[model samples]
Target chain A: MPIGDAPPLVRPIVGRANRPAITSHRGRARWERLAPYLLIAPAVLVIVLFRLWPLLLGVNFSFTGDGDRNGTPVGLDNYTDLWNDPVFRIALRNVGLLVLLLPVAVAIPGLLATFIFLRVPGNRLYRTVYFFPAVLSPVIIGSIFNLLLAYDGPLNELLQTAGLGSVDWLGDPKVAIFTVVGVHIWATFGMALVVFLAGFATLDTTLLDAARSDGASLPQVIWHVIVPGLSRTIQFVFVTTMIGMLTSMFGLLYVMTSGGPGGSTYLPEYYIWIQQGQMNRPALASAASTVLFLVMLVVGLAQIGLLRKAGRED
Target chain B: MRELRVTKWVAAVPMMAIALATIYPLIFTLNVALKTRHEYILDRFSLTESLRWDNLGAAWTSGGISRYFINSLIVVGFAVALLLLFGSMAGFALSHLRFRGSRTLFLACLAALFIPFQVIMVPLARTMADTGLMDTYPGLILAYVAQFLPFTIYLMASYYNGIPAEIVDAARIDGNGPFGVYRRIMVPLGAPALLSVGILDALFCWNDVLIALLMMPSAQHRTLMIGVTSLRGQYSSDIPTFSAGVLIAAVPVLAVYLFFQRQIAEAVTAGSMKG
Candidate 1:
């Protein structure tokens, strides 16, 4: 009967089990009070010490100097250094580029989910193939794309056969960021599509039926029905897809570009890697980490604000 | 819904094309993996004329992916086990057993979710090194648990939220303590979420390149993804062997996806719905 399983609404059983002895009652009281904390203690400790503590430590550590400057305080030196670096500037620029492209990333999945939900021909097969890429490591995706997008690779060979000039997808500074961004989208859009499908599962089919009865076309049905119905899901996808872009592209950049021929592929995450690991500038890396956090927070909060407005209007 | 069928067929055409595009890259890579270097150099797009299985063996051994593969297995295995254990415990407590600072703790966990690993990589690396846990398997495993445990707990808590309270109270009436209820009831009831979250955690730990790279700096400690990254430098001229290495790393994920696609999708959306 699984009688022992219960939900959170159960009133706390206070003194239900009669205990005659004072000491035993006190012990039971103490155990009841501490039980939840005991269960949560390991998780809370790990989160506090590792995740939250590191955030505070990273920000605090950023003000300190690295190497020769060592343990001594050097407030704003790392910040100024980060501000002056050309590669850092390019990293920030690439972040701006990602922000501009967020909608296309969101839309691709949104539209695909619509097709999948509507049960397009071979939809079952389509969903499997589409979602397969999302499961793969970016390292694998990047390697495959590296092969496919290599200068004399298959993509170029196909282009040449079509009488097009061979384009250097990875070697060109201007094109490399877009290429990486494209591959990232290719790999992740399926995840967002699945989320959108889940949202569709909760959708009011009556609304769609009414829209279709009114002779609504496909675009109108999607706009008037699905978008408004799945506002929360849409917003969720927006924030997450953006976050995924900001943080998860390191492997792609590492394998595909390594911050590139002209440093065109330097996202802040990649910048942090190079500074902390390769450049031996942990302090500077901390400063960059703080900046990345601030950037993420701003972008995240701003996205929520915008999405809420858009959601409300819809 | 009946009227939508014709339009679905229309939409299906392009969706199928996109699906082919999605599947083509890996298929393309698999084909490349089977080709000899000369065959690949002759034509990258053409199908291989012969089944050359030796490339996989060569990449497995001399290319050094096997060492990294074993390393990944050990680290991911332990990290995921710890994650599920800790995650489900905290999740049960947080969802069902309200106490002092419970809300605050949950909020703190969610706040940690906002923190990208890159944001903490520098200070974390220092913390790890300071404790002398750096460049080792336990160090890497612990780092992964720290990185992913929040998402795991969040998912499990939400999953546990769906179970009815009567079950727990009933268990209590049967003389079960909190831990007893967790083990006898919550664990069994939460199997679906456990499987879903477990697979997701496995994928995250398996696919991670950044945390592993930062935590384990030495070549011998490299995970499979790192092995793939390193292959580019070593096998630049041997495209087929490099592709073979990539196939070796991808096959496990491919198998997981094939078997548990629905669970993966459910886990992803469980996260979205909560957020």
Candidate 2:
């Protein structure tokens, strides 16, 4: 039988229960059949109990009340509170900002990966230096930037020496989110660049050579040849980068801004942390978590759909 | 040809500039770490006249970083070990064994990869608390395992799939059972994948703040990353000491990144390319 057509749980149990007859060849054959399930049992158990089950439980919990009305079902109230809360609104808006900034984030790595793919001078050193920060914790990165972006810090000092005005990098509300996002891009673009380089590794160099032989300009070659060739990688980076923006910048916001400068740098993950951990509003945080989950789900589905359509065109 | 050459040089300029930008912060932090608080206040831009070993010494001995560093080490070590063992077991079984619901289980694992920890963290925390595992080392280790196991299994499965089944058949023909093949043959064959995945998982567990924060709530249980965060508030006015603390938290990661940089990139791209 094909893997997809495997029978349900009954056969596995039947095989296991026959172990008392182990002296028989039939029992030994049954053991052979049960080995794969036995091997996978622990991983399956952990993933189901912790990862998958909690997802369902969290969505169920989101509709309940927090605090004095704890564990009591209050349908849609938590979500309404989330929608009305201004901090959560800013978090949602910042998610939108991340969506808008996604292209720039992806493009930076894509372009650099292309250059490195072409083996630019000092490409190896550039890759090493760039990827170093990606391995560092965001807390360390944030703390380091905390010094560099301080009002009288080295960056501002350099700006002052350049005869330019020193801007408040983390203190100004309008600028704090962008500043954090910029640091995030700095820290993470190397990851995407590595992914892009991996994609470039699979590209047929003959296509690039063909385009070059046709005297195509750099931009034309990129647009007509590389873009089409690496569409999947581009889409992969887009989704993963957006997911990183949404879910992984918590440490940066936590240490660098603490969702401050008037609560301006709150992403969904940080908002969830604050509501659940600091604010003691787990239900409300669950609602926000649900929204974040939905956003990711929609993004994932749309990309898969787009990938399918793109594949069809091919 | 001339145009391409010109473009390459143009690209080289920014690439070099970016490389400087990338390396500058750590250099700046190192310089700051080497300064005394007095010197840092006097001239943050100036190079330290002497390496102030006292700052690093104070940070390590008294800043609670040593405790947090041990906590992270224990949790990440056990977590990566568990992930590799469980991941390789499932990968071997799934790739080579014929079993019921195997495809469904594999798909389920794949589906679980999409559920990032943030989505389930609230309930997962409650689950941890309910089981009396919260705020404990094993609790945190289990959490890390749950978080990274799917990715680990996926990569291991993909890697093992490349091994010809005839070798497995030969091993079986040599009177080895499934567990025997796994122990005597598969584990050896899966070493490279296990190394890549283990390094990535170690980095994830070590560098994580949010999961560590949620799972280990007490001050004594903080991971190194958490220790670094606490350093910010504790040493806010003491820039040199804070820089030293940051360096202490960062140095091991720096060491790991330097040593295993290739494996890390390989693991990261392994997931992407397979997808």
Candidate 3:
């Protein structure tokens, strides 16, 4: 009986000592399993810290009286002030104008892509050429177009040689926005063309062939078959183009006009940058950013809603 | 036969015009870059009488393009590497692992796809300042990695999903661990996605200006795009030099695009159609 009791006590102590070793083994396995997450944690943390956190802070700052870098908290005055400000109003109008003119820019690439998709001779050449502008930086595109559209630039010179009146492309407020839009279209259409070409390739050739055999004209085939197949691509391009128009248009406005000649070409993005970078109005910039965010969110949601409706109907 | 011929001709006309319009700007820029100041001013649209290699040399040397080129390479290189390593690992985990909160993590990443850079520019800049990361190469790379990782992860994850799972299970049966599976099986199989993502991310980083402008404000670390922008103000009168800088800034990206056009074309088609 004494030996039995001693053996039981010794076994329990030995088991306790070995318990740590077993726990460590489990820990090692767990760590191995979690290593991939650890690898990705840096990326997730960076995005959350830099991108999402800043967005949250920006929203918070927009509401307070934090007009500059150092300030005490105030209430919703920034929003009210923007409502009363004419420059902001003009910026809003400019954005509206951008939306109106965006379709023309968007349509050009789609049509170009469709033509390329037909595999007409020189399709590769067309693709290479069409994609050239996209490879050029926006600043370059802006500068090139600036020289072309300047009062004494080649565009006006060509017009004069052709006996057409030489109009000031960047000077006239009425047409300044149009010139910016035109350049914006030219600068970006390559990426759009590439995307559309991609969309075109996925189109069911069999459906097209069948449609053609049934005596569907080219226009009808495009209208009935190709267009339907490309509906998803159209949605992607539309949303991205809208977002680009809203955000990336700043590069063009910056290099070309600097929102000059009475701020007729002033975009909201340029407006925000000026407030933050130049004027030291961090609060106002925050407010503008918040507004920009809300606008994008609403527009993006509307686009999704429309696409879903269309998807369901089809 | 007659109708088919007419159809072909009709299609060719628009395609040709679109192609010319696109190609003309690039050609015209090149032509302007080669011309003397006198020639540029005399006839802005005309081709140069003589090729000027000196303009390119001047732009490369005196225009501080050498520094800018190196800076761009550092930023783009680091950003692409980080993006690939982190993005592919995350993609593999999300697609392969059956852990809790995996779906939620994936959704969080997907939501990030919609947030534009404009929305976060000010706060992000402020954060960089607060952390003393401003005006550093690492700071710029970190920002770019954060900005681009979402789309990269999404693309990689989708591509990984398309990959057959049997190979992973087979690897597991063959005594390969998860990391081994990822390294030995998934990555090699996912090479196409990795290549396309690498090219696209490189292009994006090379062309980007806003982050470079805000983060690396010094001329010493300025990117080529920023360098070209600065040339405009400095060489306001010398249109040819400015044009030359623009041409120099465009060459690397154009070269890459031309070289990988086939892969890029396929990737873009795949992403757009499937997504």
Candidate 4:
């Protein structure tokens, strides 16, 4: 038997064997009392200094101005500037577009996981292949897609060969955001797929078995049985997919669009980057950052509330 | 589930197509990377007549990817090391040791996890600048640790929670103190969790662009992802070399994915379930 499972009486014998290791009871006790704090200090220190403290500082910094009014508080002037900027407005509109597309983003992975769960042909291979891209950096994905989506790129070449007029994918403002979002989904749905598969692992297979025995159609089984059973995972996916779209598409936008063709592809994260890094407006960037945080906060909490209500109805 | 025999096969058709689409971009890049510029212009989609390695050589040698690759290596390597050490230490403490403010500390970590980098980048840049750590290797490393430490601690704590408390008790009764137990017992026992969390943290640090961009602003300090971004502008007319640079940047991650796919999946799902 393991020492962990041994009787209490045996601990005394073990203690006696190593008695020299703890020479002083008071010293040992003091060390024991301080050990946890010592261990946690580095992590706590880094987080508080770099992560938590910066959040408070960023919000405070947002109220100040840039350049001539650097340290002087402008009292929400930066926010009004953000509100007035057309590019920021486009960024906000693109955010709304992402929210609209969130369902399609979640559904692609959910349905794929369902099929994989149902033991479709090449399920294992599909799972492995699909998840591969999720591990890749968005910069790589965007670069590759940049080649494929170029006007004289292979995609356009294929379209022309098929006798269809080729579209200017990244060069057109109307199509640039959608193209980036589509590539974002393509790159990240695998992540949600893996998450969905994990949810499938937790699912009560008996429900699936019962549905099959009852001769339920595929769509019916998906709607009634699978959806209800995996509601939590669905909700998780929805919130995460939304968050991923909002925050993680920076590399793609930077590489593929650079918020280009009149800044049509500007997400808030990219907006924050450009203002701070390119435009040298740290205060304005902070305001955009604060607004982005609020947007995420509202969206995340609203998602949880809405999903809980929907789950309850189910 | 197997009862949908016809449906499964029919579904497989589209599934295979999707799989092809998923894998095709990388394959196309690889093919293009192996092609001469002349060959690429003539036929972008065709298989390379020869396994030409010149573009790869040129990219690795002259495209600045090599420097960025080393920069990423040093930064990610140190960041992952520190993350695992601090993460496991804090994990063991929070999960096993009775202490003041333990609960609050854990909650603080959890709260930090939700604050995305964009939300924190501005002040963080300022903080780094104020401390004279901006545009340096250590600044970026510290930034990555801050960005990922919470998730690391959470996962490590969750994993450590599963190990029987009786084991810790046994170690203590055997006259080993907290540090002794940690070094002799917890680290070894926590190796699996460390590996999973370490790989995940490494990937996050490695694939990161925005943080690296903000923290390391110099031309020579670019991480690989940042390097890949510049490859586009540098080689705008040279698609083969651009693809070659991208392939170079991807190879490390692709190798890691191929080897640790299961652990990566486990770490990812563990995160999702807990969150």
Candidate 5:
């Protein structure tokens, strides 16, 4: 039978029918059939109990004040307060900076991968060295950078020696967000580069060779041939990196600046954490979380829409 | 040949520049870690004559990094184990079994992939506190497993798709149970994916700070990252000591990456593409 013509429901039963007479020995077959689910049960239970339960509880907490003010029901008052809160506005601006930097994160890795795939020598060594930071803990990266960028640290010392005067890196309100962004780009670019490299590997090499022989320049080949081919990888990296930028900014921000220099570095994730952990305003945290979730949902849907459009064009 | 060499050189310069830019800060940090407090103030980047083993020793002993290192290992070990076992099994079922709700479950798994952990951090922390699992190893492990399982399962399932169904059929004909077939056939066949997942998951769990920060708040329960953070305070100028603590925290992870550099690159490449 043709592969696509076969009924999907019949295939598994036929496969199961070939199993041994362990079933004829009474309880063995039933247990055998249920074994896979049994094996996977712990994972399912963990996700449900830990992930799903908390998600539901967060929604519930966003509506009520269960964990705030003696477990009282505050309805949507928390969200009302959040809507007018200036810190939330600052948090939104910080998130906007992150979103604006997304293209840089995607483009740098994409270009690097393209070059590596074009027979760049020592590419393996380059890849390894570049990806090294991705393996380090964000906390470690933040701490190291904090030390290096402090007013009395080496970066400013070098600047002073060069007669440019010292620039505040982590302490200045104007530059703290950029410092965090620079560190983030360094820590995350490697994996995105690797992913792009992988995507490039799947491209048809013959087409590249053909393009080259036809007098296509490297830039032309990349712009025409490689870019189109690696669109899926680009989309995947874009979405995941955007999600990381949205969520994982907390560690670096917390360790490096702690939203300091008058809260200029405060992202929504950091703002929510402070509200919940330090301020003991669980309801406001929930409200902020709800807003963050909505923002993520909107971005996610837009990404999906864009990907689908790209898929259709391809 | 000259043109080709020129092209290669041009391509390499940018890569090298980017690599150097990325690596310079780390090299600077290493230099700072070796300096004494006096040297730190005098010349943060310059090499110091007072490079003391005592600094790292003190960080290890006094900074409480040794305990945190052990704690990280235990948590990563258990979490990776659970991910491998349960993740691969779910992968097998989704690929081979034609049970009711299998498709729905698979889609659920996919949806879980997009949900960022920050969205659930507050509620998850509350749940942990309620369950009396705060500041404990098992609590952190359980949370890590939940966070990582979706991606792991998706990866293993895609890898399993590449296996020939005839092997599974042949095993079934030989009277192997579903568990037996999985154990004998699928496990060995899926070894590459499992190894890849194990390495990635282990690295993630080892390097994780946020969950460890929120879930394990006690000083005794803090991970290496937390230990390093605690070294920094308002009035203290313990740069060398803090840098030492940072170095101590990073050594294992950097060492592991260097040792398994090729496997990790390949695994990351494979996971991103397939996943």
Candidate 6:
């Protein structure tokens, strides 16, 4: 008879409580069956309790109230408040600006990797020197730039020497966001260069030779051959670079601008931080967090999906 | 070929300029750090005549960077250790073991990787407070682990994918259970991956301001990066000492870069390639 077909009166005989079943071969078999879960339990617990659970809780909490109305479900008041907030508006606008600037960010490293792949003089050394800044914390980078971009700092000194007027890099509202973004690019382009080099390692050099043999100009060879060859890597870089701009600039903003000078440099991340950390408005911050999460999900997943489809076609 | 040679040489000029631009800020900071406050104010552009080390001492002691430095070292140390232990176990199971819910658990991990810390910062803080862990070292360390474990596990799993299954099977036949096989085989085999991933995770924990800022609210609890920012406020007029404080925070990373540049680059590329 099958195990489940046994009568209720005899169920105890087949159940785990049976003495021989607990002590003999089947008990060892049970350990074997559950071993993987046992090994993965700590990781599962940590991730679920801290990362995933909090993410769900944060979304749910956004719908609730803050301060006097705490724990009471306010039903989207916080989100509407976020919508009406001007700093949040500027933050979203800056995100758009970052999206527009993404291509230039992706291209610089691509060209650099191409040069390095062609084995330029000191290419090896250049790779190390270029990559050095990418290892340091953004806080450190921001602090260093705070000095460099000081109104009377060395950058202005260099400009004055070159017969140009001093530009207040971090002080002027119109210039601060771009200046911070430029510093971020300077600080990060190296990692992308390394990724591109990794892509270059898999490139079909014979095709480059073929293009050059056909008297194809350098730009034409790059545009037609290398671009198509490295499409997947390019797509990866595009998505990662955009996400980096969204989430990782908090240190830079916090250290350099603190969302000041008319709040021109307020990215979504900085706004979320200000709302939660300084303003004590956790519900509103949760709303911003939800919005940011959705933004990232839409942008990130869309790219990965779009790129996978393109990759399949190619 | 001759024209190509000419163009490459022309390219070197801009490359050289870019390289200088890349390295100039650090060098400038070093120079400013070495100068006296008077010397820095008098002519910030000029190189220091003498190697002044007092500013470093001042930054370390008075700026409280030394205390913060120790705090960072302890927190990052614990966090990286815990992450490696948990991440490798999960990686080994997901890659090698046949079990129910394994795919879902792996997918759960991958999902966590994309939920950047800012998204859950508010609720995470509440969780910590609810558990009475906020501002504690373990609290901050646990936060770092949760924030980074998904990426660590993904890298480890990918690394383990390269290890053939025959060794694991042989180990099983030799009476090594799942934990035993992982301990003796996978952990040793995954050393290079672990090192690369460990260094990256350590850097993230050390470099992160948002998580550290949110999780550790008290001044004494500040990480080195937060300490660097606080010193920035207190020492704004005193450029040399401030530069010294910045250098104190940055020197460890610079040393790591000098030594493990290849590993760091490889780890980053590894993630990108898999993507």
Q: What's the TM-score of each model vs. the native? A: 0.96, 0.96, 0.92, 0.96, 0.92, 0.95
Q: Candidate 2 — which residues are off by over 4 angstroms?
A: A4-24, A304-314
Q: Pick the candidate with the highest DockQ.
A: 2
Q: What ranges in model 4 sit over 4 Å off?
A: A1-23, B1-3
Per model, how much of the real contact set is kept?
A: 0.76, 0.74, 0.47, 0.73, 0.59, 0.70
| Of candidates 6 and 5, the better by TM-score | 6
Per-residue error (Å), model 2, residue B253: 1.2
Candidate 2 recovers a fraction of native contacts equal to 0.74
Candidate 4 per-residue C-alpha lDDT over A271-297 given as tens digits, one digit per residue, 9 for 90 to 100: 999999999999999999999999999
Residues A157-248, candidate 3, lDDT per residue (tens digit)? 99999999999999998889888988888878887888988787778899988987788877787778877898888888888888888988
Compared with the true structure, all predictions reach lDDT values of 0.90, 0.89, 0.80, 0.90, 0.80, 0.89
Superior candidate under DockQ, 5 versus 6: 5
Candidate 2: residue A106 Cα off by (Å) = 0.5
Interface DockQ of candidate 6: 0.54
User: lDDT per residue, candidate 2, A1-314, as tens digits?
Assistant: 25653432222222234556445546656667778888999999999999999999999999999999999999999999998999989998998898889889999999999999888888898889989899989999999998999888989998999999998999999999999999999999999999999999999999999999899999998888898899889888988998898889988998899999998998889889988998999999999999999988887788668767875685
**What digit string (tens of lDDT, one per residue) describes model 6 on residues A1-314?**
12222221111223245556656446556666677788899999999999999999999999999899998999989988988998899999988899889889999989988888877887888899999889889999999999998899888998999999999999999999999999999999998999999999999989999888888877887888998899889998988898899999999999999997998999999998888888999999999999998998788887778777876775
Ranking by DockQ: 2, 1, 4, 5, 6, 3
Encode model 3's per-residue lDDT on B1-275: one tens digit a residue: 34554787788887788777777777888898898889887878767997887787888888888888898998999999999988898888777655556677788888787777877888888888999999999999998998899888888988898877777777766656567778998789999899998888888788887778878988798988888888888778888877888888888878998899876666555557666
TM-score of chain B of each: 0.97, 0.98, 0.96, 0.98, 0.92, 0.98
Q: Please tell me which model should have the higher DockQ, number 1 or number 5.
A: 1
Instruction: Estimate, for each residue in B77-156, the C-alpha lDDT of model 4 and write its tens digit.
Output: 99999999999999998888777778889889999988999999999998999999999999999999999999999999
Q: Each prediction's DockQ?
A: 0.60, 0.61, 0.42, 0.56, 0.55, 0.54
Clashing pairs in 3: A65-A74
RMSD of each: 3.3, 3.3, 6.8, 3.5, 3.6, 4.8
